[model samples]
Target: MGAATAATYFRILTEGPHVHRNLSTPQLVEAALARGEASLAANGALVAYTGSRTGRSPRDKFIVEDEETRTRVDWGKVNQPFPPEKFEALLERVVRHMAERDLYVMDLFAGADPTYRLPVTLVAEYAWHALFVKQLFIRPEMSELASHAAEFTIIAAPEFEAVPERDGTLSSTFILSDFTRKIILIGGTKYAGEMKKSIFGVMNYLLPERDVFPMHCSANIGPEGDTALFFGLSGTGKTTLSADPLRMLIGDDEHGWGPKGVFNFEGGCYAKCVDLSEEKEPQIFHAIRFGSVLENVVINARTGEPDYSDIRHTENTRAAYPIEFIENAVIPGIGGHPKNVLFLAADAFGVLPPIARLTPEQAMYHFLSGYTAKLAGTEAGLGSEPVPEFSTCFASPFLPLAPRVYAEMLGERLRQHGADCWLVNTGWTGGAFGAGRRMSLKHTRAMVHAAIDGRLAQAEFVTEPAFGLSIPTSCPDVPAELLNPRNAWPDKHAYDAQARLLAKKFEANFAKFDALESIRAAGPRVSR
Candidate 1:
């Protein structure tokens, strides 16, 4: 859509002459607060609440089942099929509802690499939502905006609710994407994640055809120009680990690895803010200042201070800020081919070692498996107690293609780049959640630093019996006792039983993949 055409589309719905276009941060913050959509916190951050729905509703997300996406997309539980007529009807309702209302529109790009970047047009009902995409997406310079054109457009009207029977929707909350029209529709939910993730899903669909691997991971580069990638599901420390002080952060979440190199898919970082502290995470701590957006975070009304520890709203509390907010962030957020790739899993079972090396075949196997502990409050249905589940590619919900498509891309990238891969468990140890404790951040950081610095390569390694992974006996500044999962446990028998049980789970999950025998053999060996 061209700029003039986009303005005309908004004009059809807008009753007044009030259409805000690419407002500055200060202007957006002031407009949000003045309109009673947001409040200023003690730290000078804008705190906005996404009522009822604090996380992305994957169940409510659907892709229009048309000739364009019917056969191309992996249709299943995550990528639910929506009738073409249903989407068209919903779009009409949304348009009528939004009509006669002042709208906030922001035109931006999704990728940092200009070669592969996507020009996006975001039309939102709320000022905070406008400010959100403004922070999350790459802002175009005045010169760039003059000749700007949008490849995809997103229209978010959270106030409008759908009737399932009348609208042919599952619920009042609906997020539908019609790629053929290059448009996305979201309604009945104020959660801004839906807006951001919908574009990510689009990239996941379109980029693969261009031989670009869109990853749900974080990337960073060292002072020596060594780049590393961390792949994991939410609450698995992909953001925390990637925001290293010594290394320049490329991005906290979502990236694309292609023939050129690795480039961040986002211009902002959406970090989990529950229990956030300045002492522990100073980088993220400092990032939350003027113009940053805090979602579902409880704030002290009197003092205007944010209670990061409060879960009254939801444990999925988050802080969204521009990439430049991080003091050590790399500008243009691009990095060379990664020298190391770390697959992070929060192992609630406490069976997997804190760190283990992966062979090339094993890397592909685990990449497809995408094992991780489902943390509480990370999703709509999950409980406090961690549940072990396999999320294919660490992002099954967002992926539009088959799992094998991404697995093959990852395998090819690793081999072509000669990157070393490792599985790092950032969850419990000694026993399951109740019996064991979460891995210390300091210790995990130490081990990660060692791995990135090539110090772990010189350390003595022992083969772990349960999964057949090589674990280092010693890591600088980390306790030797914590290196082995068996040694950390007081009861060796309990550890062995738990390890074998986890191995069985891995085997069962891997069986579903129609891969070569060698790739399957790379999986865990569980003795019956």
Candidate 2:
């Protein structure tokens, strides 16, 4: 077998078939090794394999592979069709497998440093697959047969430390005393049980002593003390929009809040890659070529490496790489008082104002409504789920604590800093998918343009009934041609039909929140 063939086998076994579940792991490994020598021969200087070792330290790593293991799960496909429960299931399985192997997982991803890795949650089998195969933990000798038969097992768990758990590690067992011992960073949407070798990569070495909370928001440390924070549920373009080539992106996704404002938990961005294109997403497309980590993506039919469109294996298309991958990814994902805090809601109903200048109450109302999508069935006959639906703050799960914890934190941060907030509806303004094209990424970009350009900061604000928020009727940097949904509506009648339908939706959805304090007059302070 040649390099391509070897790569193909490895891709299929680890990323291809089993990732989608077509072949067994052992079979894939054997075939990949069989093709390894040929791959090395064709590539000339290419080493047959490479790997790292696991040490007794809080952050210890060792890898050695020679024609043995040198493949990774596609980096771009990490979070496709992100089912909150499914990811959690995967992590739980990894814990089970760790117990089976007696190999304890430890991590120490914390601090205000930008080089550090963000936290993630991976399922068990996937985690096992990532480590042993992708990271080349298990190696082969001159003889492939013996290498194939290496026994694998699990034995025990260390006693939980009676001492205070600062970052979650046994201080005594740690070979590296100076290090904080923990399994992995738990920031972002990573649930506990999934396979998360990606987490291991960043955590292998981290700057010591800082609390980085797992959050899902874009961050940028502005030139001044001003920091701009952008929040959106997945697929709403948090990473893509927050990342401006001209402006420095502090961090694309997760951040850690501490005494001196908030710092980024990740050194980079973990972006979605399905239907990715340089034309539409030049930054993300270009990032994948260098330091970017592509997950679960199909490769070019000829390259046998990544196929951005091959979401068949999993809809969780993703790319994880440092913000540096973008020429402007800020080194330390930290920022100060936000100049603008944008709450992203991909409104599927298309009834909400295109870009609303929000009052604190409406901000909380939309945040609680958490509206932005209807997930259509990838299957042939499965009925479509409502695209525009409400989720608590649009983040249905993944806060180890509670929604209010984050809300309070957000409010406190904004208040002390004296920042302004906005609600940008990136979803359908004219109609939902089938009825009309979903909101244009262009329009969303324009809204963001007006935002950073300071136009939205001074636009005339109008009060909306259902949300009781303010919508900016005019703003600079934002094209006058695209202020309203009508600008994008091709058919006025169809647009109106969808508009009425969405209006009904708002009425219906708000009814639920009517009694809730966040949106209720009596609930929590909707706005200060």
Candidate 3:
């Protein structure tokens, strides 16, 4: 199917008598309540449940393999190929199923910068899903809405299940993206994150062709106009760290580095709410308000208070709200080229240093490696233990193109802009997860601030023998002992053994990447 076929299908899907177009937040909330789709919490945030699947179903996602994407998309376990004919048939079924229901339509923008902005139309089976996307994506003004035409259309019918045998899907859930048709079809899952991430995958493919480097990271501007980026997977504190009181938040996740600067790909934030508290994360805690949407968060029936601690439904509890909910948020969500870029890893093994400066080659090496622990409850199928994996470019799940495409773009930009890069472990310290405690948010924040403000640049540095990272000897507000991971461990030999193990893992992982000798040599030096 081509763009013309997609346009015709979109017209058929929207022509239903029960279609609701561009509903306001209040209207959406009311509709959700009336349809028994959601209930309002005491704080007025809509509480919704995603049945069966509570997190993203990455295994079921597929991209149509056609002439347009056959040669471009990096087909692999991550970017799985779906037969174009299968997609066309499945899309027809989804459109027909959705046309019969009361659909909620939302037209939104993906990028904050108009130059690179992507107009998106979301056709949702649930009113709450529409509200979720409305808050999550850029809501155009009435003036812009009058002339808004979607470059891409997402048809989401969570209730419609795909027959795996007939549809050629792995399961009942399916997230199929067709570049030729410019349509994303999602069904058999109510996980709203699928909708958010599918578009990110699309942007990851589309932006590189336009000379924009798409990133799975958070961005914020310091008081002096210096911009910093936080690249990490979920539970690594990208949203929490970027929501700093002193800095102006550009965006919490998903951004693009273009010729002008960095621009947010999202209008709002989808922050993890597991164990969320006002004391620990005041900005995110308070941001959940009237217009916000809370997913799978347990609420008190009598008092209607949300228990952020409760995770009976899932550990991936989330809060989605407009960026304006955060104080001192940049309206257009655009910032200058980042002066500092930090790669965060929740090292469950407690082997990596808390903070370390990186050479340009080391930065590229780590960027390609994209090492991070996969914490439980963050995804659909995960146990309590943190699973260590290297998500290429910190966004392998979302990147449709080859890893080198993003890695090369980042290298060129870093060289052109002269941005300093650092590695900050936000995971465990002293010993592995079973033995040690998580790194203090206070200490991590102090170190991050120091790096962002150039305080760490002035500090003396020493090489870490195992990984070859430059460990800062001293940092303001941080204890000197905590600056080095080895010193924090009770057993020196045990720490060395753990560090050596991690170094071996790094060496093994980096061997898979086809990079320059300099970049490869920049990796951890596993000692004999």
Candidate 4:
């Protein structure tokens, strides 16, 4: 099997536990095989794996396929409607073929070993292609790609080729740039490496300059044709907040900004699926009904479908697929100048003001201070407490451009189109999330509704003490009880203490950018 096969197994591993839950053994098997075939077809088997043999690896272990013919271009995956009930039919065929031929499948990460009655190795084996494509779209760099490899090998231009699987050797992509490539073996997360390679192969020599800059943001286009950009690090509710009923979601993560406007680099959205509650965020919950790709999510034992609100199995919960998976996902996932830009921060320290209309300088300052809480299980301790962390631009690790470049582009776009910018805190209301309490989803939703309806535009405002930000006293139709931080603070002292600490954190986090004050933005953060 090729990297395409790796993708098939990844689907099985992530949504595997759910595939046969509602069905019997025969039906489940059929569904599994059918799902695999559909994935291969939908992900573009006709294009990706079709190149002629180019060369062999230095070890003579693998062969590199044709690069020009390869679909280095983009492809979309409508995962849900594919193969449909034919899963049972395809399952019946694969089982009979494998069993009749006495071919025992080796499952790299088999859960309880499949009942196929054949020898199975429950190891971790997911494809590196998807991540490669994602990397290419978001952060295409040879050195960056190498750092995500299987064995931590250094990356260089094509010097060696990959051998084929039938040669009794492993054939993988080393680096994606110059025709020559080899696969690295990532133990637990096997897919990140190959995915990075395929992505880089696209612009290896094609583009004259890397003008497109990758951003950690969600994008949406309003009915009025204006796009609203939401930039945040993980956990600030970018995915949850941007899935608005009134607008079209361009994409949830990873956008590429160019002269044409902002285009979502990813065909899909990588959402934080941990402990997901549909009732709380009905829009996101409803988006995953079918055809959406589930990644590392835990399913209920009985239903075989995802239990979004449950975070017991994993904290690094995610899903990947074309934006169309969501009912209102934008087709091209690109849009023009945004009328509104939001910088979301999950302020754990809670010292920052609730909301502020930022100046371009302040916007850049907060954009680089991407703050949020880590999911409980993603770090060292599982079923334990979450740790709050901050990353510049909420994307220092994976962004394709310098922070100034992104900020400049954002400023220019907003200035050119006359956009309004806001720094919204989604972290904590009282002291901090773990120390105090998380702001209610209802309240956040209410605030968003108010903003959407223009109810808060003329609301009473006061300059926040710490950041000198404007805070609105009330939003129309929202409860008076939920307007300010004090309402959520049972102990005012704790709230004040946490807020100060959080502000200090931001100041320290932004110390690196003190020298970039002279950088010019695309436009002022606020105003026409």
| Top candidate by TM-score | 3
Q: Each prediction's TM-score against the native? A: 0.96, 0.61, 0.97, 0.61
Top-lDDT structure, candidate number: 3
What local lDDT does model 2 show for residue 525?
21
Write model 1 residue lDDT over 251-305, tens digit each, in one string.
Answer: 9889999998999989999999889998878899999999899999999878889
lDDT of each: 0.89, 0.47, 0.92, 0.48
lDDT of 3 at 198: 94
Per-residue lDDT over 190-241 for candidate 3, one digit per residue giving the tens place of the 0 to 100 score = 9999999999999999999899999999999988899999999888888999
The candidate with the higher TM-score, 2 or 3, is: 3
TM-score comparison, 1 vs 2, better candidate: 1
What alpha-carbon RMSD in Å does predicted model 3 have with respect to the real structure? 1.6
- Residue 348 in candidate 3 has what lDDT? 90
Q: Rank the candidates by TM-score, best first.
A: 3, 1, 4, 2
Q: With candidate 4 superimposed using the best TM-score fit, by how many Å does residue 106's alpha carbon deviate from the native?
A: 23
- lDDT order, best first, reads 3, 1, 4, 2
In order of listing, the candidates' clash counts read 1, 72, 0, 39
Poorest 10 consecutive residues by lDDT, candidate 2 = 38-47
